[model samples]
Structures are given as structure tokens and as C-alpha cells.
Target: MLLKRIQPMAYHARRLYVELMFQVMGRALQAVSEVDETVRREARALPAGLLFEMMVMPDGPRLVVEHTGDGHFLYHGSQAPRAVDLSIQFKHIAHAFLVLSFREKTAVAFANDRMLVDGEISQAVRMTRVLNRLESFILPKLVAQRAVKEYPKELRLPEKLLSAARIYLRIVTHLFQTARTS
Candidate 1:
């Protein structure tokens, strides 16, 4: 009986963790693409209105984002009406959290089969690059190094800090807009 109770509580906590990560990651993706020309080019190469999602299993939070035209994307709620072009579905809440956890590499997660891709392979690769770029901006050197195969050494410290600040500010503004609209 105690085990059953603890299991549910743990699940809820992990679920909440995954959901919050998705929210921030979603906004950061959009914000980075807006600010980085290379990322913007990558985003533009994708189909216009193409929606991407990272989700946990049944009833868990889903982060949905759409590639609006002109190299920009907007985060769409999980309930958004548009069709999802590609989705990276985590096996479970803990699995999602583990892969997204600080200092955890997504490539390792993929190799470990923690995530499943439900769309085109090319798009997934492109999305991976976008996520890697965003992570480089937001995560610390130690943590970001583990997340991607390479952390660009060319990126100056000041530039990275500035980009992170801008990305965070944009994320907060986006969250405010999201909350107000919701």
C-alpha cells in the first residue's frame, strides 16, 4: 500500500518537472531562432507552419511549436489545432526528464532509446541542431558540453551571456502572453 502511494506521488513530481522543462525549452527554441541568423536559416528551411512537439506519455504536458514563415516560430499550446509535423515522444515522464535533465545528452538518450521520433528523419536532425544551438546559449559550459557533441569554442563568453539574457527575457514575455491568452 505504501509503495502504491509513493509511486503515484513520484510520478506526479516527475510529470511536473517534465512539463516545466518543455515550457522553457519551447520558448527558448523560438527565441533563439529569432535572434540567431544561422538558427533562423535552419528554421526557414523547414515547412512553414510545421509543428513540432516534445511530449511525455498519456495526459502529460506537451510542448508544441510552429514554424511560422520568415524564419520565426510561435509556441502553440498542446491543444493547438494545427497538425504536428514531427513529434519527439518520450517513453515516460522520468525518461523525458532524464533526457532533458541538465548535463544529460540528447544523443545518448536517443541511443538509449528513451525517445521516439514520429516524423521525418531529416526534420528530426534539423530540430536536433536547433535544440543544440539553443542549449549552448542557455546552459553552462560544463552542462552544455555534455548535452551536445561539441560546444562551439568560437562563441565568446560575453556573447553567450548576452544571448542567454535576451533569450530569457523573450521567454518571460512569451510566457506572460501565453498566460494572458490562456
Candidate 2:
């Protein structure tokens, strides 16, 4: 297997991923830091009154990002927007913030033991929404994808399960989102 060629099987799950997640978060932190005075000024130009405080916690079998924000971070962030905290254990990076925007399915899965989540629930959800519109979309476009490709492709999944899971997740998530508004 490609994964085997690169590293031993011991480097497969949790241990391997903890390292990877930190790396991903590192880039995210850098993205936050690197935003220039002008660029951030524009990004912060959402509304004079809308700013937020976001905290993400990936603490579980699958990644669990917990968010805590009042939806106002910069200008009138004094009273806090509306505190939202939620937790979810999502296995794929692709589905990260997208799920948080519209559905609680992932949160349910985590609570039912099929997934995992820790800490506050509302914040988890808030963090994810911010990421969906902010880090997830903007960072990739601003930076090259090559930097985060160190993980071997095969380790991305167990070959037999990858195709089915990815396709199924995409379809289900798409349909769910589509159904949400209508």
C-alpha cells in the first residue's frame, strides 16, 4: 500500500492525526496572523457592529470543532452576539464547517456514541460557521494547497471504505443542505 511504502502502519490513526490536526491549525493560526492591516480591515468590514470570538476544539475520535462566539468580534463586540456552543465529531476536513451551518446531525452522531465531541456545544457550532465562511474558504485560496499535503493519500482512509464513505457523505450532506431551506 502507498501508506506502507511511506511509513509503518503504526503511523495510521489517532497518533498520526493528532500531529496532522496541529499542522492544519498551525496554518490557520498563521492565516489569522498574516492578514495585513488592509486585508483584515476589509475582512473586518463585514459590519461595524459584527465581530466575534471563536474557539475551536477538535477533541474526539473524529475531529470535534467547538465554537464559542457571540457573532460580534470587532466593533460592538461588548455584549456578545448570541452565545452558541456545540460539539461534533466529523471525520473529514471537507465536511467541517459545512455541517455546522445547517444541520445538527453530526452533533447527534457524536452524542449517540457513533462520534465524539467535548466541551460546549453552541460554541462548537459557532466556530464552525466562522470557519466555513472564513478559514475554510479564504485560506485555501490565499495559500497554496501543497503546504498541507504531507499526509500520504492512502492514510486518508482504508482503501475499501474510502470511495463509499466519501461519495455517500457528499450526497447526504448535499441533499440535507438542499432540504434545509425548502
Each model's backbone clash number: 0, 19
Q: List where candidate 2 sits over 4 angstroms from the true fold.
A: 1-14, 33-114, 138-182
Task: Indicate which candidate wins on TM-score.
Answer: 1
Every candidate's lDDT: 0.84, 0.35
Show the colliding residue pairs in model 1.
none
The sequence of per-residue lDDT tens digits that candidate 2 reaches over residues 1-182 is 78766554443443445444433442332233233232244334243332233222343222222111222232111123444223344554323332332233344434544444444545445443333333322333223122221222332224324433443454355446647967
In candidate 2, position 89 carries an lDDT of 43
In lDDT terms, which candidate is top?
1
Worst 10 residues of 2 by lDDT: 62-71
Poorest 10 consecutive residues of model 1 by lDDT?
Answer: 74-83
Q: What is the lDDT of residue 23 in candidate 2?
A: 37
Give the distance in Å from residue 50's predicted Cα in candidate 2 to where it truly belongs.
19
